[model samples]
Target chain A: MSILEFSNVSFSNEGKSILKNLNIRIESRDYISIVGPSGSGKSTFLKLCNNLISPSEGNISFNNKNVSEYNPIELRKEIAYCFQMPHLFGDTVMDNLSFPFKIRNKKVDMDRIKYLFSLFSMDEEFIDEKVLNLSGGEKQRIALMRTLMFTPEVLLLDEVTSALDSENTLIVENIINKLNNEGSTVLWVTHNDEQSIKYANKLLTLENGEIKSLEVLK
Target chain B: MNSGATLSTSSLIIASSLVLISLFFSYYQKLNLEKETIIGVIRAIVQLTIVGYLLNFIFGLKNPFFTTLLLLFMTTNASFNASKRGKGIKNGFLISFIAIGIGAFITLFILVVSGAIKYEPYQIIPIGGMIISNAMVAIGLCYKQLLSNFKNKREEVETKLALGADILPSSIEIIRDAIKTGMLPTIDSMKTLGIVALPGMMTGLILAGTSPIEAVKFQILVTFMMLSTTSIASFLACYLAYKGFFNGRKQLI
Candidate 1:
């Protein structure tokens, strides 16, 4: 079963088109990597899956139901997204990590957070540490952890590791790749050609707001 | 004691001599403010003269409808000017009008209900003017601050939404911050009321020959009124202004 399907989806802002007549199906557990030029609407394409942006034309369906039919907040929970430059709210790492649970009025799962932190090689003390004092790589890791804390059915990565060092990047890629193998579909957007080929089972190439080519890598 | 003393045209012109000092400074210092200072003084004279007669007429009539109409006009004018400060928010006039109107009306209603103020033109007009104008400033600050904060923290907000968080959870901190910025001036002014400088209400009442104790009482009431008005107005403005930053799809506009 497909987790996400975009059929003839096109989005335009002001007058310029961002994505034009995009057609794609993201099946369950498929690890897809999207590569494109800077302005080729890679981020916009990821946003469409969660309905962060409604298509100006055509339709998007998630789990066989039109995305427009689902409540956006609920839909977003099932399809988590992370951006290129991570933003951590509040003062401490706990604030960012516990937010997903906080919004749901659920208690924070300390064990889960600790395990995820250890997987990312984060120090146990870093959980209580202020986000303001963290390095860029640390902030990015925290952001990724926050997204994975909920364990969504699908994860959207918008060049989330772009600002990280190779070491941190590998940690992130390893975690995301592991999650993908664990039955969570992944739509990873990256500029690193080697990383895309290695992590993605299916590769999508976009140019000028449309898909130029798609290849089955593995 | 010179009780109920009034300024005649001759006395006013004598007072005008003080402004000449400013004109002189503008000339000697080459400040290039000579024309502006002269025009400002003249404009104040003309505007105040017109307002004096208008107030005299309104007071004599003692009609509730007329007083209410004038209050609305003042609120509208204030809202119009305040809305200009909110460049990023759409329909800022409506936002400011609702904020100021609610803050001023609720405060005025409380004062009237408690019999602290007589609902007469002379009592309500001045009190309402202060409340509405202060609320205007508060809302303006809120609108500007909210817009700027949201713009600056766009990534933060978008990141949360992308994480399946709703608008409120995403931007709650920024909302609180904007409200604080909006209320800062009023809070600071309240803190500095007697030590830093005397407020206008107390000074005016004293000049009008009201007892010092009475003047202090009214000043305290006005100060309290301002604090409440600013908080209410800024609160409303923050809620309304934050909406402008997001769309129906919950994306940042």
Candidate 2:
């Protein structure tokens, strides 16, 4: 079953067409990369998927259900989005990671948090450190870990590694590849062709608010 | 008669010096605050003069109702000033009212019940002034912080919402941080009160013929009252402001 589907989606802000006649689909476990220039509506597309922005026209369905029919908050749990610039709250790293669980009233998965931290090569001691004191790389890792805590069925990554150094970028890219291999549905947006080629199982190229090309990678 | 004459002359000298010094600082320092300084100095002089006469009458009458009315007027005006400073905040007046009302009442009741302040107009007026002024500062700071946090961390807030967090929890940190930042000025003032500067209450008490030790004691009491009132007001204002930032369904406005 297609986990996510966008059919003839159109969006405009202030009567200016930001997205027009865009269509795409994500099968279960598919790692899709959306490549486009800045203002090509890549972020807008992700936002629509996450219901941050409603489409101006056309329909979006998730798991064969109309996107509008699902509660945005519930839909968000199933489909988490990572922003381009990670913003951590004025709290400890542990608080940042456990916020999703705390909000939902779920038990803190300490093991999973530890595992994610180890995977990102972060120190366990960082859990007690204030988020304000964290380096950029540490913040990005903590932000990703926070999003992943809920184990969302699909992850919408919007330039998640764009602000990171090359070393940190590699760490994130490796994690993305691992997540994809482990059967997570990933929709990633980036202008970096190399990152797209590295992890994308399916590539969707957008231009002028429309998908110009769709290619399946081996 | 000699003491009275000395007090009057000293008051005039102090008032004039404050005005001249403020003007000189505004002009020579090129602080861009010349207009505000001039207006503030003029307003202070006029307002204090009026209040001085009013206080003479009130002290003579010493009626509880009039004192209560005066307290209410001060709280309401302070709350109004707070709301004005918190522009772009919806229903800010309501938030300020709740903040000032809760903060002032709690602190004043405690002070009165503890016998720190008598139930008379003299004690109530000064105590009310302390509470209301701090509450005003607290509300203003909390509102400013909340607005700035919302502006800077908007995406993070949206991200939380998209991650199944409700509006309240999503905004809890912002509100908490804002309140903390808002309370910092009050905390700093308390810390620097005697060593760095003599607070208005202490200075006023001393000028009114109270001994230094007595003036210091009153200042300490007022500081404690201000701290408690400001904290309560800031917390209430922040919580109320958060509600205004959302819709009926708790979605961000």
lDDT of each: 0.88, 0.85
User: How much DockQ does model 1 earn?
Assistant: 0.73
Q: Which pairs clash inside model 2?
A: none
Name the regions of candidate 2 deviating beyond 4 angstroms.
Answer: A1-17, A21-31, A54-71, A87-95, A114-142, A160-184, A192-202, A213-218, B1-42, B53-65, B155-159, B243-253
CAPRI accuracy category, model 2: acceptable
Question: In candidate 1, how many Å is residue B4 off?
Answer: 1.5
- TM-scores for every candidate against the unseen true structure: 0.93, 0.78
**What does the lDDT read for residue A186 in candidate 2?**
95
Residue-level lDDT of model 2, residues A1-218, one tens digit each, is 79999899999988999999977878999999899888888888988887877888999999999988887778888899988788787579887888887888889989988898898887899999998898887787888888888677899998888778899899888988888788779999987889997878899988999999989996
Error of 1 at A153 (Å): 1.7
Local accuracy of candidate 1 as per-residue lDDT tens digits, B79-148? 8988898887888889888888888888998989998898899999899989888888888888878888
Error (Å) of candidate 1 at residue B30 is 4.2
Candidate 1's residue-wise lDDT over A13-126, tens digit each? 999999989998888999999999999999999888888888999999999999888878888999999887888888899999999998788998899999998999888899
